[model samples]
Structure formats: C-alpha cells, structure tokens
Target: MARHAGLQGAGRQRHGYFEHWRRKDAGKPSKLGANKRISDEALLVHIKAIHAEVRQEYGWPKMWKELLARGIRVGKERVRKLMQRHGIKARGKRKFVVTTDGKHDLPIAPNLLARNFSPAAPNQTWSSDITYIATDEGILHLTAINDLFTARWWAGCPTGPPDQESCSQASRSFRYRSANGRPLADNRWR
Candidate 1:
C-alpha cells in the first residue's frame, strides 16, 4: 500500500516503531534497574541456602541474621522484599501424637459393669483394680475396692512383689462389701 502512495522507501525506516512498542509495553525503564541491588541468581541462592540451614524454619528476620553473619552487607528490608517476592516464609504446625495397637492377643473384658457409677446403695456395684506405689521399703502392689454408690474406698491392701495376696485381698474386699446386701459381681466366682 505504501508503494501505491509513492512511499515505497519511506516504510523501510519502520524499525523505530519497535522502540515505541517497547516504551508502551514496558513503560520507559524506570530508575528501577538503576539499583538492581541484588542479582536474581544470588537472591535465589541465598534463599535456598537459608532454607537449607534452618530446614526452612527461618523467616526473613532470622535469615537476615544469618546473612549478616555471613558478612552480607544487605538490610533486613531487602531480605524481606526478596523473600516476599518469592513467597518464602516460616510457619508452625499443631503437634499431636497418635498411638494405636490393633494386634494385641489379649481378650477384651466384657463390659459386665457398663459404667454403672451409680449403685442402689453402698457395695451394690464395685470396681477394683491393681496399681502400685513405692516406699523406701520397696515397690508395693496395691488392690482397692470402690463403692460405686457411696463413691468411697471401703477396702485397700498393698503388698510387695512375689506376693499372691493381691487376688485374695480383692476377693475378700469384694465379698465383705456384697455381704452387706449386694450380689457377688455376676455371682459366678469363688
């Protein structure tokens, strides 16, 4: 079309249009690069270095400290700016431990006494268990009878290791409590 207007050679100087396109697209390079304080590679390398040091647990401030220790003459703001640009940060997590064992061979006891914390009266329901306490004398095995209705310890016995007295004490405590009127727990025991 230019040739049709007798301007065949005029359009040859169109290379300057590229400069106009550059100015429009990138906006005349501001004094921005006049101070490209840090190189892209150096900033990324330092960030990765700090991450390796702290296992990625160091934020901008701590990383800044490390940078200073390394004799890097940069300020915290610059570090923060770089880190923010790259979305680098440190955060925390909630700590909880879960433990489960589904392979035990022991039989789960039947809930014969399903949380009957209430008994018609004292000795009507009893819960007994064995625990241990220590004195200067030695480790003592313990057995106790709790009155579900009264919420009181009516009987307790403690003995040293190698003693089979725990079973006997538990039996006697359970008997005495039930003799008052309650039934021996399930009524099928000696």
Candidate 2:
C-alpha cells in the first residue's frame, strides 16, 4: 500500500502515514472528526455577539477565553484569524489628551531665565513645570518645582490639570530663599 502511494519504507513506518493516505484516498475526514465543526460564518456570528456584549473591548485572547467560558469550544488561533479577517478589534484606551488651548487669547509669561539653565548658585533661579503621569486609577497631574543650580526638585500630584493654585502649593512646599528673591518660573507657557 505504501509503495503504491509513493511513500518509502521508512516514511510508511512513521505514525499516521498509512492512516492519512487511506483517509485521503477514501475522501473521508481525519481522526480529528470534522463532523462537529461549524462553518466560519456560524463561528463569526458567535464572535460578533460576544464582541458586542463586551463593547468591543476584548482582543483575540480574551475573546477566545470568553468563548471557552461560554461552552463554545474553539481554538485560540482560529478566533484570532477570524477576528482579523472580519476587521474586529478592541477599542484602545486614550493615553494622551490635549490640555493646552494654544489659540486662546491668554497672556503668556515672559522668559525671565533667558535660556540660562546653569545658575550661579542655589535658589538663584528656580523653575517649575507641570506634566501628567498615567496610573491604573486615572491620569495624575504632576506639578514640579526645581532649583536649577542645586538641581533640587519638589513635586505635587494634583487631581486635575496643574492650575495656579496647584503650582503655588508646590512652590510653597519647597521653601528656599531665592538669591534674587524671584518667584518660581511660571509654568503656563508649557
């Protein structure tokens, strides 16, 4: 039988070689049983239903797990292929937001430092800035005050965007007498 099928003696001895050729010649399904398998259209229906239930928040991994959890037995790679073919995707979380209004008619702060980052002494020139940090809970607004010469810095995590009050609070916390007694650099320009 192996010689007729063009399989050598060693190849015939390999597991499932004869069975595979036998099934192929007979036009029968393999041992894995194709009878229980549903059509791609049917599977896609289930996938779309689950996607809507979760508000399209689950990718292939989560979607496959959800299918298994719901008593629908399917392969993970199959789920991924179907989702990719059908243009199904998870809605990603927004990581960045434009907080600044550049078109507004707001008064800009003057550049007092004149690009001199290296100060002669500590407290001679203090700078402050505001930034954001992403956390599991939400985004945190960080207001930081820095002494250019000494490189000493203080930071405060405010609830919302760093406003005048938040920046003032951060500057107040870092109590150091400035050499020229100038206020902390305004962060509104940032």
Candidate 3:
C-alpha cells in the first residue's frame, strides 16, 4: 500500500501522512487560528489524565506514550515540541538541613584563642571544643582535644548537651589519656 502511494525511500512526512490519522469520525474541529482559536483544553485534559496515571510524576515522553496508545499517531517530536511550548517540565527531589542561632542571651565565652597556636611541648597547651553529631539513635554531643606543640589529639567522649560538666569531663579525659607528661592548661583563648 505504501509503495502504491509512491512514498518510496521517503525521509520524513511527505505523502500518505493522512493515512496514519485516517478515521471516519475524526472530525478534527475547524481551521481555527493558531493563538486565539486554538485552545489547549483537550490536550491539557489528556496531559492531566496522563499525569494522574503516573501519580503525577511522569514527564512529557511518558505522557506522549499515553496519547499514542489511544491510536493517536503523532510523532514523538511533535509531542516533545508541544510539551516544551506548554512549559511542561520535570521536578527534582530535595534534601533539607537545619541551622541554629547561638547568638542569644545564653552565656557565651569570648574567643581568646585568637589563632595564637604556639606551644613548646605536646601536652603544654590543648584546645577543646564541643560539637553536635547526628546518629541513628539521636543527636549526640562531642568533646575533642588538640595539643598545640606536636598537634596531637586526645580522644574524648560523645554525649548530649556539652555544658560545663561536659567541659570538666573533657578536662579529665585529657588528663588520663596523655602520653606526654607535660601539663595542659585550660586558659581562655587569647
């Protein structure tokens, strides 16, 4: 039938294209103008139907498949072009994070460390800091120690709410865990 139509070796839409859409009841409306007359009411209905079919997640290509399943012999390019013109697009998943404000009326210490970073021996000066860590159980607080001279670290404890007691606990951890016999001072940061 195609050879009889004389579309031999045809590259694209040329002749017999109407055969694909041949329906006795395909009363494809009137020759309305492009903008004012052409309303997407029907197409939008079809797209929304497709959207619901995929739980409102499928994009244009899959939506086009739904149209093609209904004996709608439209080209993929036409569907893609129509979707782009109508601002159809896919969305991405997002992950969220939380932030805290430490600038309230809570008692805060001044930064006296000032990046001085000078020490004669391993245990002579140590810097300690408390931080929060998320885990499978819950939010856990951590206390860490750093020696300024050899820059060695003291393994500390992970707990909740690193308060004055936590700092005192870290001081004891540094005392018992040090190999170098030099004493450490907890002087305020300069």
Candidate 4:
C-alpha cells in the first residue's frame, strides 16, 4: 500500500497506515462555512435582478462580468452554477423568421418529374435547385443543374438571390444537345 501510494516503508510505518487511509478517504473540505462574505441566496437575488435587467439575454460569463461591474463580489463558477441550477438561460437575439410564405398568391409550378428521379438516357431529364451559402462577404446564392440519367451536375454562383437569368446561365454552361442538336427540354427551367 505504501509503495502504491509512493511513500517509503519507514515513512509509511511512522505515519501509520490507518491515519493515512483516514486522510485519503476524507473528501474535499466544505467551502460553505469557510467563506462567509456572501450567502448563495443573496448572490442568487442579485443574479435574478441582473438577469431581468438585461432582459435575460446575458449568459453566465456576461452575468458574471455584470455582477462584478455592479460591485458584487462573486466567482464566475458560482454564478454559472446558481444560474444553471435555477434554470436561468439567455434568450435568442432574433425571434423565428418565417422565410417561406405558403399562403402567397404566387403561381406554384407543376411537378412535371412526378418524383421520377432516374431517366432512361442522358440529357433526357434534368433537375435544378437554388440554395444560399454564408460567406464572410455576405450570403451567396448558388444555382445548380443536374443531368438525372448521367448523374452529372453544373453549378453557378450568382451575386444575389437566384432568378431566371441565373438558372439560364447555369443551364447554358453545360446544356447537352439532343438527337436533333437542339437544347434539352425547358421543363427544368420552370
């Protein structure tokens, strides 16, 4: 046991195995009575007040800093623990934004493909979709065209939101010719 504990044989015997065991078994000393500067309940009151004052937008780190600014002496960890224990949380900056308006008067396109993804031959069927990408400059609009049968795709990055011109540009980039050497069907453009 002394060897396992890194204690020399003589030192272990002098200290007594039971005494060493007792000290080792004892857990961390309680800080509740050691520090009498402020009670948790009082600190919690201040935390609640600050939380309300900030409209509940401040998390534990910000809350801790605010408490310090207001002359309240409290540890950050303690504030975090109390806030977590009491279910205090920061609210999101913006409320949910409804991007899509399903009730609009805009004409909805017919589902021509009818969920038939696979085509019998290359250039027989094509699909297109628009998506946005977040970049340091701003949000970039991406327009993509896909040849279903060949599983080949072409993409174009437009300056603003994707529109008819962007789709045409993307299609023109890699438009495969049919048997008569004419552009592929315009169904994908719709």
Candidate 5:
C-alpha cells in the first residue's frame, strides 16, 4: 500500500499536476515576454483591421475562421475572449415597423362586414388589405382586394411608397372579366 501511494505521488509530481492547487499572483499582471506582448498587440490590430474591412459584422466564430485562413494560430474561445475584452460585438437583426397609423382625426370606417366572411354571392362583399414585404432591393407595399364569396382576387398592386391614391385608383380601374377568355367581368382599360 505504501509503495502504491508513493508511486501515485511521484506520477502527479512528474506531470506537474500540483501546480493546479498552487496560488497565482492575483495583484500583479502576468509576466509575459516582451515579444509575446508585442505579438498580442499586433494580433489585436489585425483583428480590428479585419473587422473594419468586413463592415464590423463578423463575430468571433467567423473572425476565428478568418484568422485561421490568414494562418493565425489561435483558438475560437481565445478570439471570443479577445473580442469581448476589446468591446467588439456583432450587429443584431433589424426590427419590424408598423406601417399603419390610427392617430388621425379622419372619420373611421365602420366594420360593415363585422367579421362575417360568408357572402351571399360574388362581389357581394369585398375585402381589402395592405402589407409590407422586405426584399433585397427594399420594402415593397402590396395592396390587394378579393371577393369573400367567390374567393376571387379582384385586384392587386405592388408599390414602393404605397400611397393611398395609387391603391384606390388601381382597385377602381380593375374590371372583372370579358371574353377573349379573360375572367367574367368586362375589363376595358381606359
């Protein structure tokens, strides 16, 4: 038993595992070599340059990958720690905007339909709505109208600015269909 204990102690000492329990210098900064400190600063400069070149969007994971591609030997966590320490962070997603404004003193339209979607016949009840769509170019506003009974789409217009006049004009000009095999309403564009 004594021999076994002695052997275990010897193995621990050999592997320098005792250092794990030893106290470190808490007050003073680490005594890194001059060359190491200089290299660390140089790495930080390179990181900042890359961040700016990428429009400051790349986070630590991507930055770590970039560093790896540039032949910089660094860990991902180390890069994260460095970024956090230097106050570097990635941009967040944009917030959605509410396009509707209800604060105006204009006369509010009464809900004639009253959520009664079942219409007696085609064109008996029409529904209109507008929504905004995000795209690569920019936000697109789509205004559309449909018949509640026939489920037929009456009119639709996609505009950039989404003004009220254009939407009303577009819907008003939309005639149902005529022959030449269009729809059913006589659509004559004047």
Candidate 6:
C-alpha cells in the first residue's frame, strides 16, 4: 500500500510520512475532544437535563435507564463515566438509629385506652407516637398526634433527637385544638 502511494518502498527506510503513527508519544494521553464522533457537550446536556428531571436521585444505572427512556442512545458505562467525571452522585442511604429509648425516668401513663384503637367520638382519644425516618440529610424524628376516631393527624412535629420536647410539641397541637378545653381522656397531660 505504501509503495502504491509513492510514500515508501520495501527497500527504502521508514521516514516522516509515518512519524505521526510511529511517534514515541503514541501511548500518551490525547488532548480533550480529540475523539469527535461523540460530543461531550451534547451528552452532558442530556445528563444534566435527566439529573434535573429526576431530582438527582437516580444513580448511574437508573440514570442510564432514564437517558435511554428519553431516547438517548448511549452505553451504561459511558453514562457512568460521564457522571463520575462530572462529580454527579446520587443521594446515599443514611444509617438509621432506633430512637425509642425505653430506659427513661419519665413515668409511664396507664393504658386506659388498652388495645381499643377505635374511638367513638373525635377528641375522645388522641393517640400519639414517635417514628423515625431515614433520609439523605440524616435521621429525622417525627412525633405524631392523631385522633383515634377519625384517624386524622391532629398535629405532627418532626424534629431531631426525638426527645421529650418534640413529644410535648406534638401533644400541644392536640391540646390547642380542644374546643371545650376539657382534659384528655384518662386524665393525662393535665
């Protein structure tokens, strides 16, 4: 082929014509955008749009699926690489800690309601409980107060630490709503 192009002959030594191919820098990294078949800008635009649409919750695999769903033809590894290069990461799962502390000095209230979750009238029984949820931010302690009859949230206070203060705040919402100012059933929280 070289001979037909009049560049090299079998008897002649190799010259500058092939220097670009046989250079010592062959294994070195190429400049950015050296490969032009795939435009990084376009792919990045799509990735950014997908990230925004999904609220940055999708990791590489799910992000790749979302991109494919959006009609973008690209490999999963390519999307992974792009996200890594751009420092795009998903919200990680937070470590959860049980907030319930049974070893407390507060006196326990008697279970007057006693397994009777069903209340006959509103405000007759306001049940309260504390629940913990794991979020990317951190552990959140949610104290909820609800009417047993209607099963509606009378009040809810989401706070950190799940301490007695939060429980008091949640109960206050029910207390503030009591129209007759009557004490709660079972004569608690007076």
lDDT of 6 at 84: 97
Order the numbered candidates by TM-score, best leading: 6, 2, 5, 4, 3, 1
Q: Go through the candidates in order and give each one's C-alpha lDDT.
A: 0.64, 0.76, 0.63, 0.70, 0.66, 0.69
Top candidate (TM-score): 6
Better of 1 and 2 by lDDT: 2
Provide the lowest-lDDT 10-residue window in model 5.
178-187
Model 3: pairs clashing at backbone N, Cα or C within 3 Å: 112-189, 112-190, 113-189, 113-190
Q: Worst lDDT window (10 residues) for model 6?
A: 181-190
| Superposed model 4: Cα runs more than 4 Å off | 1-97, 176-190
Clashing pairs in 6: none
Off by over 4 Å in 2: 1-58, 61-77, 81-95, 176-181, 187-190
Q: Sort every candidate by lDDT, greatest first.
A: 2, 4, 6, 5, 1, 3
Every model's Cα RMSD, please? 15.5, 8.4, 11.5, 11.5, 10.6, 11.1
Query: 134, model 6: CA deviation in Å?
Result: 9.0
Residue 180 in model 2: shift from native, Å? 7.5
The per-residue C-alpha lDDT of model 4 at residue 125 equals 75
Model 6: CA > 4 A from native? 1-36, 103-108, 118-123, 130-144, 149-152, 156-190
On a 0 to 1 TM-score scale, where does candidate 1 land against the true structure?
0.37
- How do the predictions measure up, each by TM-score? 0.37, 0.53, 0.42, 0.47, 0.50, 0.54
lDDT of 2 by residue, 1-190 (tens): 5354654544544447667668878998776464487789999999999999999999999999999898778899999999999999999996667887789687777778888888776777777778888888877888777778878766654657667777767666665433354555763434
CA deviation > 4 Å runs, candidate 3: 1-5, 8-115, 179-190
lDDT of 4 by residue, 1-190 (tens): 5344644534545345555555556863343333657888899899899899988999999999999899777898898999999999898775554445689686787667878876777777777776777787877878776778877766654657656677777766656433421234343433
Candidate that would win on lDDT: 2
Candidate 6 lDDT over residue span 11-31, tens digit each: 543454355444536863243
Tens digits of per-residue lDDT for model 3, 1-190: 5534654455545433544344323755322311232236666667666766677666778777788787454567766777778776555553454445666786666555567688655676677766678788977878788788877777577878656777677777787877654434342321
